[model samples]
Each structure stands twice: as C-alpha cells, then as structure tokens.
Target: MQIDPRGPRFAAVLTSAVLAASLITDSGVLLAVQALVFALGAAGRSPYSLLFRAVVRPRLAPPAELEDARPPRFAQCVGLAFALFGLLGHLTGTAWLALAATGLALAAAFLNAAFDYCLGCEFYLLLHRARPRPGT
Candidate 1:
C-alpha cells in the first residue's frame, strides 16, 4: 500500500503555523486551526491526498502494507490529544500549555517525516496484532 506522507507534512505545517500564530496572536485560535486541520485529515476528505500532491514529493515510493493501514491509530490519537490539550489551554486562556502541545505535535510530525516511523502506525499495528482476524 502507498503510504501518503502528506498527512505528516500537513501536520507539521499546521503545528508550526499554530505555534507561530500562538506566539503572535491568540493561541486558542491557532489551536483551533490545528484541530480543524487534523479533523479534516481524519475525515479522509482527500485533503490528505491533496496535501501530498501539493506539498510532498511526487516520486515517493509506496509504503509497506503494515504501514499504510488505518488513519486513526497512533498519529491521529496523538494529534487529537494534542489538539484537545490545546483546546483546554485555549478555554482556560493558558498560553503555555497550548504552546507546549503545539510544540510537541510539531516535533512528532518532523520525526515521522525524517524517519518514516509513524508512532501512529505503530499504534495501528499493535491494534491489528491484538485483534482476531476474521474466521480466527
């Protein structure tokens, strides 16, 4: 299966944008933007594909089957958590916490990009292994 790298790239961009925007404007709004972007990705609205085509490389090789599974395993979880944390911070007007979550998200996204070792992919694999296959 082809592992689209666009999600991670968009994540990185969203994180960076939110983080930077947080520094200048309202952190809460930035966090909201990040959350919206993530939600879009999770919806599989073809936004991921568009992002991959627009920003990521065109000649990227296909990914391993195990790596191209679900879109909501680990990375999505982490992203959701981060966005939630940011929302918490936003609600409480806690700039520091929002900044922290955004920073961490950015770091994770970059790591995934550099290593192709998606923490989310690990989560999906773990779930897949734990489950009983059909007719098992």
Candidate 2:
C-alpha cells in the first residue's frame, strides 16, 4: 500500500514529543508507552495514524505523490527497537544505557519531524543493497 508522504512525518512529530517527555522526566513508564506507540505504528495500526488520516489529511491538499508504505514501516520497526532497548535499560537500572537509547530515538525522531529525513528507511535501502543478488 502507498501512503501520503506526510503521514509518516506527522507521526514522527508525535513520537518526538513523547520521547522528549520520557527523557526529560526519566520516566520508564513514558518510555514504554512510547514504545507501544512505535510498535503500533510499525504494524500499521497506530491510533495516531488513524487520527491523521481522518482529521489532518483532509485539511491539506493531497500529496503530489504517494510512497510505498514499506519504507515508513521499516522506519517504525527501527524506532520500536530503540524504544525496546530504552525500556530494557530502565528495567535493568542502567541509567546511561536508557539515556543513550532514548537519546538516539529522540534524535532520529527530531530529524524526521524537522527535516523529513528517515534514517531507518535509509538503513533499509542500504540493507537491500548489501544483499546478494538472486540467480547470481
């Protein structure tokens, strides 16, 4: 499925806010909640996405082009991985680890939201390029 290019960026902005809160408060619960949101997004079942579709998308002109959904979905999975690591760090009493994980996630989210850059999507492309070709 294809999606409006703005959809993922909108979700990124939301993710960045929650992540910022988690870092600022040093709250494990907030981190975990953010992780759940990322997981839902990765699975293409996010409430945020739904809200954006129903309420936000209609307000703007349609996108100039639709993008394949896989890139954004892959980005979400990377985001979920980071959130999981942050959760683990919090649960294990490793402050540095948790901060690092959440910090990385926040940076990525900020980049996506502010610049429309998707590190996870770029990683996905790199991984595909690294794969051995079939019928070689």
Q: How close is every model to the real structure, measured as TM-score?
A: 0.66, 0.97
lDDT tens per residue, model 2, 6-69: 9889988999999999999999999999888888888999877898999999999989999988
For candidate 2, give the lDDT of residue 36.
89
Q: Which stretches of candidate 2 lie over 4 Å from their true place?
A: none
Residue 1 in model 1: shift from native, Å?
A: 7.7
Cα-based lDDT for every prediction: 0.63, 0.92
Residue-level error in angstroms, candidate 1, position 96: 4.5
